[model samples]
Target: MTATIIHLATPEDTVRLGQDLGLALRKGDLVLLSGDLGAGKSTLARGLIRTIADDRDYEVPSPTFTIVQSYPDLRLPISHVDLYRLSSADEVDELGLDEALMEGAVVVEWPERAEGALARPSLSVALVSDGEGRKALIDGETAALARLQRSLAIREFLAASGLAQAERRYLLGDASARGYETVAAGTEQPLILMNSPFNPGGPVLRDGKTYMQIAHLSQSVSAFVALDRLLSSRNYTVPKIHAGDLENGFLLLEHLGGDGVLDADGAPIIERYEETIRLLANIHQQAWPHEAEVGDGTMHHIHEFDRDAMMIEVELLSDWYVRRISGIELDGVQKAAYVAAWDAVINQLNGCETSLLLRDVHSPNILWRRNEVGIRRVGLIDFQDAMIGPSAYDVASLIFDARVTISPYLQDHLLGVYIHERNSAGSDFDEPDFRKALAIMAAQRNAKILGIFIRLDERDGKSYYLKHLPRIQTYFDRVVRHPALAPVREWCEKAGIFSPES
Candidate 1:
């Protein structure tokens, strides 16, 4: 029963409203647009499709005659259907919208012609003439309504930041609810609108704290702003925050080019990888403050990636992966043994050198600016979950990236590059200790990733991550063989954690 009324002062406002709602659209969603002739229904639909297509000037000819027009190549393939000519609700089935929805979402104009045959829509927009403009009465399911409200909030935030006229296009979204959009204003190069909402923490599960709290995940966008400013101060290549709404969790950030460490073929670029390692070495070599004052006059405190956090993440392997993947539930005795094994491994990190770790320095978070010289070519991002942890964690994360199938030769080369850079900088780079830390961190990360990928598939219905499980498993199997993780390897083997049957 969630509903909202939006006042559109102009045709542009109507289009913008559509764009706002488009941000929330997903596959299998039904967006019903009802209105009289010349009520801007088609115009609004055009804006929505264009936004989803990430092309502002995309041509969206009216589907009035065609009955249906499908955009199959877009990120979210959608079909625009016009039911104005339907004689009865029974005719609705002839349009094949139900079949279209199986591929993606559908936007139906003149849905009133369908009577009650259409399925319950995720969103319904009723447009009415208001003076020279229009008024839209919107209502939808709770999740859809919340997403629409958040999208409108982003619009308001952009307006307050003097980017009301900017063209916003869906860039990308992560496994988390956070999303990113590319905003273009005039000719001033594209900027990133970080659409991160305050996490508010999830349900409390342990020690009267939520999983996010135990994991030390960033609950506020201010962490990103603070870290960005901190790194920028140190001459590291991070997005520059032009404006931010700390409370509302919106940030207008610099777009640090589109190139990443991966090439067009999605293979790791060797030269870029070497430069990234150099950048990481420089960052690890520096001393960082535990707290920093951001532009908003609020102090952002960086948390330590303690043993508790690492242990909780490793437990994911048992909690989700073991049950779902291995089809076996761990008894109390087995669970405790598994925990004890991880405890011993995490304890090994006690005396290891600690530094600010970005947690995920994988290919996706890295951007390459080939035009920029030296380390400046490497742009760092997605570090909101940054923590003070073993510097080797970030190195391990990159070398054993969960997203890509890194060859063993490439892996060894990258490790060699990191170690050489650390040594070349005259940092007391304990080769043996660093190698051990890297192995332990690699195993821990891969275990957590396996659990997360399974959880994402079972809980979130995001099956895309399941493809990465094999790569991560291979990586984990290799790293757990290290002597530093002997106890963990033994426990996993005894528990049939990675049996051939699994």
Candidate 2:
């Protein structure tokens, strides 16, 4: 079953549709209103809020001047944010819209201004005005949308094409614009199928009867291309691209299923960490041939890890999450300590050799699969940001992960296993030197993660990441606790980098 697109006959119908959707709204759910100017965007938002609030006198005007307007009087405090006034993505966070998202329902006008800021919706209502009528398309997640879309009868036409069953099934999961879907043709076989008006980077069904991820072109396309090239030489598993219309940012790919490595239940923490480290070792071992193809050069360079760039990100954390939200002002001594600690870490990194490092190697980027031996195997994803850098960069990312917390014991055991594997692989790395490199890289990775989490919540309206800050900080503390990193730790402490009050 897939979601069906319906047309509304009048403005009244649009309001009614909004009211219907408002009745179903829940906490932490996002409603994105996308339409042209005067396409009844605000009118629809007004109807939704009115239905929930039921207060006739509540003024529901366009929030043009004020980026976000909150109405807490309703059953669920509704946040009416108008991004039309936003000058840049950074300004979105300053408006404190993320807080509104956390408390109640969010009705966003000109949401495209902060498109990636919101999570994938549970329902998306696109209003297209035509003459005296409007088009109202409702996309429900999984069950509701699938049942509706299948009733529309376009499924047969899509299936007859090269599109596979699995492709159709996956597309049915899309709660946004229809592009392609993955469906299961048989109990074991899946195929990729196409949806009309294909949006670049949106998911699509491929000829092999599997669903592929095609969400956005700018970053996803580049990332997948790099992953494709890497898979050609390594034993690692990434979603295989069956068919790609790169110009349109659409690709048919093999579905790796929804069960990711990090989502494994009751798995031993050390085992998970060990599997991940082994895969990283495999990635580092497979050297790219001089003639091997490379992805677009937009990836970050380790050489770009200069003093200025590092300081800018450190300042971002200090300004946004720490100072602005947490109200912790850095004293002069603390500031100087942070600077010195950062410099020491960077100076150490400057001396180590570099390799192809996947910048984002956290939980979400890895998929866990069951192997024949009943043990779980880890598969990597989201490597478009891969770059030439220190091998420890990836190790730090896995051990000091932001999404999940790994105990110090597991971290040490995993690190030992990784070192053993690397040494056995005939690499001539100095143990002492490698340990130092790991500490240096761990500090840099944690610093970058802090800034990213802030950006994700404040700038992007994804506050779920805020809860992981303490865990990530623990990783920083662990690294700095080492004798080799004592100087850096002293610097961080002096700077109040880990100040409990801060």
Candidate 3:
């Protein structure tokens, strides 16, 4: 419903904007190209095609003579069409444009000849001459237009922040909507570009609060900036923030190198694991303020990982995992009992002394920097969801990681290392109490992961997460053995969740 007009002052601007559109393009989408001859329609199309192919030097021959050209090697098929030579809309149909629409995205030049056959809620790019440059107006439906606006926003961020001329390369993206890129400009030590927009999830799950509110998830890039300062102050390797547009959710951070804690076989490196544990041991003892300043005279108030947040995370088990394994959702009575069980444990968990919890201290978020000294050797990313919670929570996250299996022997050794380190700093650190809390937190974390993984599969179609269910089940089987989590163990047994093992 919104129209966005971007001033494409240069060919580079046009190309970068197209790349943004290309990244957001999905299968079965239509992009209508409208412009005069030599109006940069072909240039824009080339940029879009090259981005999808991930080839900077990709040759995109104009399809004016051929009517249409298809690229099958791309992640999705792309059909580049030229309708100027077409006689009528019927001739367009004879080219099997309908079938191409069924298969992949279609980008059509001179779309007006089709007489509005292109479909509504479509992206129409109008490229007109503007003095020494070109200006483009993007008109489309709300959803599609929103995506294009985000792309323009990113381009503006890069431009206004002096990174307009940087070379960009795709880095990584997760099951979530977030994506990252590496920016290299001249001799500048390459920076990481995080394109994480605040994702406000759907309807009121409870108390008029959405899932993010209950889970204490990062709703803005400001959270990452704040937590980055908090962790960096303690010598943790949260990436150094270079420039950021918090409103647009674009962050340019110092590139922490590519060495991960996982070896070639994808197992956790013992040496790195020990270092990660030691880092957590050291971090948990520090006094992190609830209020952190994120530079530019802005103060970010960190939200605590309180009862509602803890309970909401653990409820993921009942939400998705139960339906997958038991073939039904948790009924009213079962849900009530599950909630009561978690509520009681959360109360006891609150009694334990708390510290900053790196909610995802697992292998993927950890990078091994061998040359860096001490805790800085473990480069931390994704601590945007960091909150004040039990130190044992992060301990559980590290040892009982979801992505990588920490063997029983290594798990015990690492657990020992973590406990000894904590004891060194905390005089009144109760080993037995901490161990019980670790078990409680592990069970909660593993259960939440089970639901999250299954939801990723069922709803988001990320079946790759299903591969970790056995490991998660094993973690559940082990952690629920704690007397404090007996209620959860009983529920799991009744649900027949532990009938199989890895």
Which candidate number would show the highest TM-score if scored against the true structure? 1
CA lDDT of 96 in candidate 1?
85
Which of candidates 1 and 2 reaches a greater lDDT?
Answer: 1
Q: Model 1, stretches more than 4 Å misplaced?
A: 1-3, 499-502
TM-score between candidate 1 and the true structure: 0.96
Worst 10 residues of 1 by lDDT: 493-502
Residue 326 lDDT in candidate 2: 49
* Candidate-wise lDDT, in order: 0.88, 0.61, 0.83
lDDT of 3 by residue, 1-502 (tens): 5557777888888887778778667667789989998888988999899888878898899998998999977876899999999888867667776788778889999998887665653588899888888888888767777776776677678778787766565677776778887777565468888999878966679998999888888878888898898777766787988899888789988888889999899988888999999998888777888888787689887788888988888889988888888898788998898888887777678578788887999988998888889878999988888888888999999999999898889899999998888778856788888988998999889989999999998888668889999999898888788889867777667777663222
Clashes of each: 0, 43, 1
Candidate 3 Cα outliers beyond 4 Å, as residue runs? 1-3, 59-68, 71-77, 83-104, 112-121, 175-177, 199-201, 347-350, 424-426, 459-464, 500-502
lDDT of candidate 3 at residue 311, scale 0 to 100: 87
lDDT of 1 by residue, 1-502 (tens): 7469888888899888878878888888999999999898998999999999888789999888888999999989989999887678898888888888888999999998888899999899999988767899999888878888889888899899888867788998888868999888665679999988899787998899888899999998988988888888999889988888888889998898888888788889999988988888888998988886677778888999988789889988999999986687899999999999999888888789889999999999999987789999999989888899999999989989888878989989988888888888886879898889999999999999988888898989889899888889999989998998998888878777654224
True lDDT of residue 502, candidate 2: 33
Question: If scored against the real structure, what TM-score would every candidate get?
Answer: 0.96, 0.58, 0.89
- lDDT digits (tens) for residues 1-502 of candidate 2: 3444556676665665555465456676677788888778887788778767754345787788987788887777898888987788766667766677688878777878874766566566677765567776566476434433432333334333354222222233122233344544454735444332333432344332211221112233444565556664565676666555443344555666655545357334555667888878767766543222434444422222345544555545555545644468777876676666666657776667566776777676676666522222676646654555677878888887777887777778888888888889997767777778888778766766676677777666667777888887777777767666666666556545564223
lDDT of 2: 0.61
